[model samples]
Target: MNKLNVLFLTLSSMENINERGIYTDLVRELASRGIYIHVVFPRERRLGLPTELEIIDNIKLLKVKTGNITETRFIEKGISTLTIENQYLKAVKKYFGNINFDLIIYSTPPITFERVIQYLKKKHQSKTYLILKDIFPQNAVDIDILKNNSFIWKYFRNKEKHLYEVSDMIGCMTKGNVQYILNHNPYIDRNKVEVFPNSIEPIDRNNISIINNEIKEKFQIPAHLTLFIYGGNLGKPQGIDFLIRVAENFYKIENSYLLIVGSGTEYETIKNYIDSRHPKNVNLIKSLPKKEYDQLLRSADVGLIFLDKRFTIPNFPSRLTSYFEYSLPVLAATDKHTDLKNILIESNSGFWCESGDLDSFIHLAKSLADNNVLRKQMGLKGRDYLEDNYDIRKTANIIMKHL
Candidate 1:
């Protein structure tokens, strides 16, 4: 049987590891299935090359230099003066002209790449898959980042429509996302859309053990305290201010700690809040290496997930995988419609509260902290649910059928 030549297009933070991005695991999974995976990413700062190529684990990585742009500022709402679309096009023409792919899978947020996908499909006769991670223009409108009936709305909406039109298949992360796409854009071909949730390779529990004491000592986590960790991006979508309020409400409680172990635009805001208030129970740390973070997850009593209530799309954070991997119970606070709430409630993983409800959040936190048996049961249930529903091997099989 001939292996499929898969070209994956996305903006990845790194190529080699699965620390903070989506493409790494997707690449690894596809590679494991005998797919010839190639990645194209914008050049990293301090490394000046308009186009460079490297191979890792039988996969090709083509790094294209767009003008040097700081991702930090871009992530914080700073617009890129340099046109990434032109740069990406030039890179594809220059570096990837020799290769023909069976399928082109494009992930989006910077939905400006629809033109590139169209070009690829025209040039190579390859099927285009839109890995719909986030609903951009609609999400912007939902969050008030882009106003309805405004120029910005019109501009992004057109771009989004172009993307949907270009994709042969649209792979959404959740059923709600698929419904959102179909309902909002009634013109889109309904048969082309499908749900493919985020997945990870299951952890080998035999080889992994909770390093409770070491993690506690390193982070100054109290031996007696039950640690609740929020371990991912701290940004507008997460409603970090609500987390601060949760911390404040529970500051006086004994044997309970809140540790946030990631960075984002709101990192400084969260840090400043912690410093100004001097909450003895809350600790803020920059993102750590995956092994260390995973160990922390294994040791922690509860995993925390939060999202802004106003988000237009029902987001299923990939961070929940770490929690399930380590058999840690979750306390997710978000909009009622999110699939996370459904999974949590159905699996008996933990509790859910309204996004900004400090009172209910604190109440659940305190209850979980006090009840060891309940926490253990919830954790076991979550681990079992992940094994049944979210193993990467299972998801890979589904993808194989599509291919």
Candidate 2:
């Protein structure tokens, strides 16, 4: 067997490898499976470190400087993502100039990696694969961030198309995403797209048990109230306005309570709602440490997920992994475009409601909250579904097969 060299391009921060994350786990899996892996990602000025190389175990990671794109406003994010290319290109050549990579794997968010991908592909004659985590300009259009065919729209849209064109194959996060690409962009060959769901290293639940009262007491969460928690990015992409509407609907319900955690661009928007409304049944915690957050999930009764109704592109959030990891049942409100709702229904692991349907969401959420036996049954199914489908080992095998 020939030993293979791989280059991973991503926008994820590698500052803390000890903390578990999606991309880190995937790369680690590949490394462990006897694949030679090299990762490149941005290092912010806030870390106060020069552009440098770090090696962990056998995997090589190069951290280069880039603008603060995440956790910022729209204009800043645009500039940061676009400007990251030059920095990434320089770093790629500085370190990897002599090496011949077998496969170049990358993810989207900053589709500005076109030049680097094209450069490396030509140099090494490498197989390029895009882990298409997002479909951008259309998402921007959905959220009113960009006007149709505007200068900025044309720029990013062209970049998106070019990235697709350059990739040897495109791995989508869902079946809906695959179809969205093929459906809208008739120019793309149907053979180029396939489902590549977000995967994680499944957590051990053998020693875990519901500490019903301990966490509830500590957090001042009521013992009798059925907790419905949303514990990921709280932002426009999540349809915060609709989330506020959902919370408002349940504010007066005695048995149901809502817990909103995580922070993002729209954190202040959520914070203000909580302060002004001061609803009895809703608690908005800004954010929590990952360990504490895991503890909270283990204690919670239900996990909640949301996506903006306006999205024409299917968006899958990885927070579903945390819910499945704890054997907690989920209730998702999503746009029709994503088939996570379908998967949840098919697995019998959770309930789903259309993003725009407050009445249906309220009905399902209340029905699930009222039935402990049903919730427990679904939670068990969720664990089975996650293990069978999304285990990182399986994900690694899938990518390796393509390689």
TM-score of candidate 2 to 2 decimals: 0.95
Candidate 1: count of backbone clashes, pairs at least 3 residues apart or interchain: 1
Compared with the true structure, what per-residue lDDT tens digits does model 2 show for residues 170-206?
9998888898889989998898788787888887777
For all candidates in order, the CA lDDT equals 0.80, 0.86
Number of the top TM-score candidate: 2
TM-score of each: 0.93, 0.95
Scored against the true structure, residue 12 in model 2 reaches a CA lDDT of 89
User: Candidate 1 lDDT, tens digit per residue, 230-310?
Assistant: 999887778877888877776755689889999887899989988998887888999898878878887899999999888
